[model samples]
Target: MKVEGGCHCGLVRFEAEVADGPVEVLACGCSICAMTGFQHVIVPQSAFRIVEGRRETTTYRFGSGSARHIFCTQCGVKSFLTPRGRPDAMSLNLRCLDEGHGLDVTNVAVDQV
Candidate 1:
């Protein structure tokens, strides 16, 4: 399935191909993710693409500095990340997606919850 999303201000847009059912959505308890209420699913970098607004995005790293948190500079929304694990994957925020994407969000496990 192809999923689309962006920041609250619409300054950052992206599209990704993901498995259609029984997806793994994580509820990260790390400092930044905890503070931001960021729940997500990790996907391979090749499965995801920035459709627009690259100029409006910025990266933030901390601690071990492996995770690349990409946020919209315009709205300060942390929309996605180059996950520390498995290096080739990205963690995209589900809440940022366009509506009617047919995601069964409520059925997934919340890792840190």
Candidate 2:
């Protein structure tokens, strides 16, 4: 299934190809993710694309500086990021996805580390 999403201010937009069936989201207990209320839908780098506003986005890195947290400069919303654990994959914020994407979130596993 192809899903489209963007930041709250609509500056950064993206598209990703996800599994067609039920999807499993991750709710991380890490300080940043917890504070931002980010729900993750991990996808391979090949399956994701930045459709717009690439120049309008900013990157932030911390704690080992492996993960590249990409956010919209205008809204400060982290729509997607390159996770430290999966450097080759993209971790998209489920809450940022546009409605009617038809994603069935079957499970939300809490990951605290």
Candidate 3:
């Protein structure tokens, strides 16, 4: 299904068409991921698009300087980012998606770093 989402201020909007299923998602064992607690089906660069809010978005890189933490400058809501552990993949913050279809995230397991 096509999922549309953005930050709290709508300053970092995006649209992505993803498959409907329990995809292979990982709860990272990294310092940032451990604190933020993100989860989702990882997608390659080809799967995501910044439909709007490019100017309102800002990036923060740390650690190995591989991950690009993209978020809205207005609300500071991190809707998505490129994964450092898997440079080729983008990590979608499931908490940010507007899943009006009643998405279920209960069974998604989360392990600490």
Candidate 4:
């Protein structure tokens, strides 16, 4: 399914293609993810595209520094990231997606910490 999303301040926008069926929502117990309330909806990087506000995006990394966490500099919203384990994948934040995407959200625990 095709989906659209962006930052709170409208400084960023993106489009992505998710699985055809139910979207898998992974909830991580990591400190940063938990504190920020980030819900992971993983999709391959080839299926994701940034449509606007590219310049307003910033990258953050820590620990292994494998994943590149991309956030909106203006609104401080972490909309997506290049996942550590799957460098070829982009993990989108379900909370940032526009409504009516027909995603059947499921909570799956991840030991990211």
Instruction: For model 2, give the RMSD to the true fold.
Output: 1.3
Q: How far is candidate 1 from the true structure (C-alpha RMSD, Å)?
A: 2.1
User: Residue 16 in model 2: shift from native, Å?
Assistant: 0.3
Q: Cα lDDT of model 4 overall? A: 0.89
* lDDT (10s digit) by residue, model 1, range 1-113: 99999899997899999887767778877778878878877788999999999988899988888888898998899888887665798888988878988876643544342
Clashing pairs in 1: none
Write the residue-wise lDDT of candidate 2 on 1-113 in tens digits. Answer: 99999999998999999988889888888789999888899999999999999999999999888889998999999999998888889998999999998998964657632
Better of 1 and 2 by TM-score: 2
In model 4, the runs with Cα more than 4 Å from the true position are none
Q: Write the per-residue lDDT of candidate 3 for residues 1-83, one digit (tens) a residue.
A: 66778888877888776666645556766777767766655667777888989999889998778889887999988888987
Model 3 regions more than 4 Å off = 101-113
TM-score of each: 0.90, 0.95, 0.81, 0.95
**Least lDDT summed over 10 consecutive residues: which range in candidate 3?**
104-113
- Per-residue CA lDDT of candidate 4, range 1-113, in tens? 89999999888999999888776798978778999989999998999999999999999999899989898998899998888888989999999998887888878889862
List CA RMSD, all candidates.
2.1, 1.3, 2.6, 1.2
Q: Model 4 TM-score?
A: 0.95
Q: lDDT score, residue 13, model 1?
A: 94
Order the candidate numbers by TM-score, best to worst.
Answer: 4, 2, 1, 3
